[model samples]
Target: MTPPAVVEIDHRDPALQAAFCDYVPRVFRTVDFRRWCEWGEWNDDYRAFAVLDEGRVVANASVMRMRLRIEGREVIGYQLGAVGCVPSHRGRGLSRGVMSAALESCGEAPVLLFANKNVLGFYPRFGFKPWEQALFGAAFHAVPGGEPAPVLDLVEAHVREGLVSLSEEGLAVTERFGSRGHARIASWYAANAFSRPLRQLHADAWVFAGVENGTLYIDDIFAREPFDPRPHIPRLIDQPITAVHFGFTPERWWPWAGVAGEDSEAYLFVRNLGPPSGPHRFPVMART
Candidate 1:
């Protein structure tokens, strides 16, 4: 058997980067790292560590330098994503090599990752403990027979550029617990994963949302200015919604009706950060 070589991929090297992107879909079928990088959102903060067997990437972990706002305090942290090992390389401890490299590069900073269901048991070996995240919701009265908001195409050059600018200038969605400098990661989901329409309410405000089970789920709201999104909710409703659920923290934006429950869908695991005492939700849009 060939020895595994763990290396930090230089994304500027086209061939090595392409090999890394190729490895992503083989492990995580749904994500498109290639398109995300190609769309020009991949910034200098993101770095990929990979285990290469005979120069072919077989296991990988990618890290991003994060500026987090935890309980109104600015924290310099790290986020791990695009973590996976090809099926053929499983059980070979290849993931550990990449993870070690990735973590070492992060130094002593706090780190976090949202694990896939199958890998819930994997992160604990690296001193990561599962963390609970709160969900915020409120009763929403939508206008009956309301017109749908115009959808913004995220792939559009102007839209993408605008969001990148807003990400730097916008106020944190929640100082209680949110993120900073996260537009790059958010663009990946906007382009590939989001099935809902993204509606621009203002020159600087955009909302990504959809209706589900009479609930209007607002996945994310990007804005450069501080504005109340509540007033614009009526324009976003395509039908009558009984309630509104926010994916990102609304402490700075809305009067949330308290914690609805734990966000079970987010399999969050962290290292170095203590469990949040009060209700907290990591900004959904900021996650990688």
Candidate 2:
């Protein structure tokens, strides 16, 4: 009998892409499969590996190429995401084969992934160790009455330049603390990370935030100068915002909040294909 072939599929191939998209819903019930399919439109740099059984995709893994600033130096790396196997194929080792193939293709680049608690014991076989890093950010009470930040068209050169400055500063802070950071922000990432039509509260500030459950979640913020959340928090959304939470640890602590220690989640893991480094922080925008 011929064994199922495991190979990397070109995302541009519509037929294979559709098959891969179709397989996702079968393995993971919680995700919006339609939105997951739309992810391919903004992300062109990813490669999908699949295990085909009888001409159908039965297992899949996605590897996304990313440019990261590790210890103040820019390095190319890969992020592993959307790893799954069909229920009937679970015990057959198809996922292991597909993951092994994907890692082999990356050569010497570092790979990062967020695994669920259920699979905590699985990634260790691939040399992925638990990454324990602190989550720092402040909680702010909505002050109300300030003008909202202007929505910058990220496609424009000047707007992009402004965002780039913020990214550099953010990297500098991470580098100071002996952590790695992502150097460049792709337009596709911004469009997906932030809301569609990409809105910002300040003209000069590049803050990627969303309002949920009456709490504003600040995912990422970058500005040429120090950003004060005071003015823009209130006007971020028309509905009354009770508080704001940040994903990154701000350089300057806001008076309205205090830093507290919290245990890191066990699902976050990393495999260093090169030299070993100290504790590192992954940007919230990069999380799958």
Using lDDT, give the best candidate's number: 1
What Cα-based lDDT does every candidate model obtain?
0.82, 0.62
User: Which runs in model 2 stand beyond 4 Å of their true positions?
Assistant: 1-4, 32-44, 139-141, 149-198, 211-215, 222-226, 237-243, 252-259, 263-266, 273-281
Write out the backbone clash pairs for model 2: 149-201, 149-202
Best by TM-score: 1
Error of 1 at 231 (Å): 1.5
* Candidate RMSDs in order: 2.0, 5.0
lDDT of 2 by residue, 6-87 (tens): 8777656777877776787687765433443453332455788899876678988778776655655767778887798988
Off by over 4 Å in 1: 1-3, 144-148
| Residue 73 accuracy (lDDT) in model 1 | 84
TM-score of 1: 0.93
- Give the RMSD in angstroms, all C-alphas superposed, for model 2: 5.0
